[model samples]
Target: MSTAQPPEDRNTLEDSLDALPELSYSMELVQKVQGGEGGAMDELLERYQPRMRRIIAIKMGAKLRRQIDVEDILQEVFLIAFRKIEGLELRSKASILRWMAKIAQNVMHSKVDYFSAQKRSAGKEVSLHGLAPSSDSLEPQISAGVTSPSQRAARSELQELVDRQVERLEPADYREVILLRDYQECEWDEIGSLLERPTVAATQGLYRRAHLKLRKQMRKHLEHPE
Candidate 1:
């Protein structure tokens, strides 16, 4: 006959798993990386690398500033974030996103500062900031380029008009706001968690405003198309 497992052992195992929360587990994984978990550390970096790259793309306006090499910024952001992520207080994924945003902002600022210093050293105003991408900044950012007849005709055209307006957003900052709210059908609370906003209502309003702007822009695109 086998001996019965102790209740306390089962509870302890559950608690350990619970520490890795499903809601915003990415944030917890980052925390674990700070605590020196090898697997968690690697996963965290891999997961956000693409996102970090996209943020860099928008910040440098890669299309216009062909020389910016957004990857440079991604490296810088990761190095800094790896250092400071532990200090951040993330109650949800929204909070985690805001933390990531802060890191991106700081990385861009430092790049600006470095370039400005270089310009001063050379006695010229030729700083290394990139120009913004065009309204058609497709490819990796706007177009995952999913092909289907369903998205090929009028609907595609209509959606492309809306997409242009989205690119005009605060340089890759609010992509989650659009993707989650409209594309993924995420609820307002989930959005608020990612954005660090105070309430679900606030997130809803943010999405509502975006939708209104998209509609206005879509009408204009259809009217012109030139």
Candidate 2:
């Protein structure tokens, strides 16, 4: 008689299998790019531009978004990506996408820093820390349950660990759920369209499952770190 494997064991087996990278269209273009085919680079830019734009828009705060154009930021990101592409060790299509996303985030952060400095220099800076929290405000507090700087740092590190695990998730769809829903903050409908799901409900379900899986993985990692 065959006995059923536990969920965790089954998941581990599946993840091990899925960890092997397969050659995809994006990977093919990356190879062409490495071979000095300039057209491949343009094709990659065209393929990923929309998604990169959405990520930039979502990550750019309201203050920066008002002062700078998203398209300009995107252009800068693409240029940086192009220059750095030669140095990248392309592991998979997801790795390429993640590399571009990291570039976009860095560009957005630089813009935010520039504008913030300008505001300070102009004497127009506002201090939100002096004001009381509003009922509708979603800003998290460092003192609610957190007491020390180390605790805050630990929380931040934990968040980063979770994000890394999400990026490393097998079956690219699972990774897309976290990227779209949590990182990009895309609407359920938009996620459905991007993922080609039948409906918003389906996208929501995918996000929920992916989130739970991530949480489980984090817990296991914390309990038994390698």
Candidate 3:
């Protein structure tokens, strides 16, 4: 019997295997802002604000989606960018977006850790007999024999590894494609717009190439594991 992988594992495997396109409007805005032109930062923010919010919302995950406020995180991300933009060396438009995404990812991870700790502490006060089996308890069964905690840790590590590899990819377009499609989970249309592709099909082809490269990198990582 063939056993299905857990959703997280499947998505991680599929998504990890994933471009920037030509310089467009955002690139010009990034150049202007980097050059310290007046009102350029505001224009850049205006252009990317929606994209940033979408990225934060998607990365927040389902567990924290209801509990955490995306707007607050979005504001904090932009605020940090505002304060630190001068010091940052943004080589391309993709670099700026990726930098912002990293900040959002860090903030979201910290929040998840905080809430998880709170839940763990509260769990300890409850009677073991009174507690019901959680999704955690059923993880192995749901994962087709893989333990949840360990699998989750491995998945997280793999994602981090893939992200680092993506940074080293040649042609900034490939890096941007992975960041937007895989990391942020944006739709092809949106990705196409950002990448300045004429159609979703063009963007899809770009993503496929990027994914193949990422898969090769992952294979190498597994083989070496250093």
* TM-score of model 3 (CA atoms): 0.44
lDDT of 2 by residue, 19-84 (tens): 212348777887788788878988877666644654465455334556777788888988998888
Best by TM-score: 1
- Tens digits of lDDT, candidate 3, 34-118: 7878487787775566446545654553446556677888878888887777766555445666678878777776676676677
Better structure of 1 and 3 per TM-score: 1
Tens-place lDDT per residue, model 1, 136-198, is 222222223445555444333444444444545542325446644433334577667767779
Off by over 4 Å in 3: 1-39, 124-226
For model 3 the local lDDT of residue 86 reads 71
The reply for model 2, stretches above 4 Å from the true place, is 1-23, 126-177, 180-226
Each prediction's Cα lDDT score?
A: 0.51, 0.58, 0.58
TM-scores for candidates 1 onward, in order? 0.53, 0.49, 0.44
Indicate whether candidate 2 or candidate 3 has the larger TM-score: 2
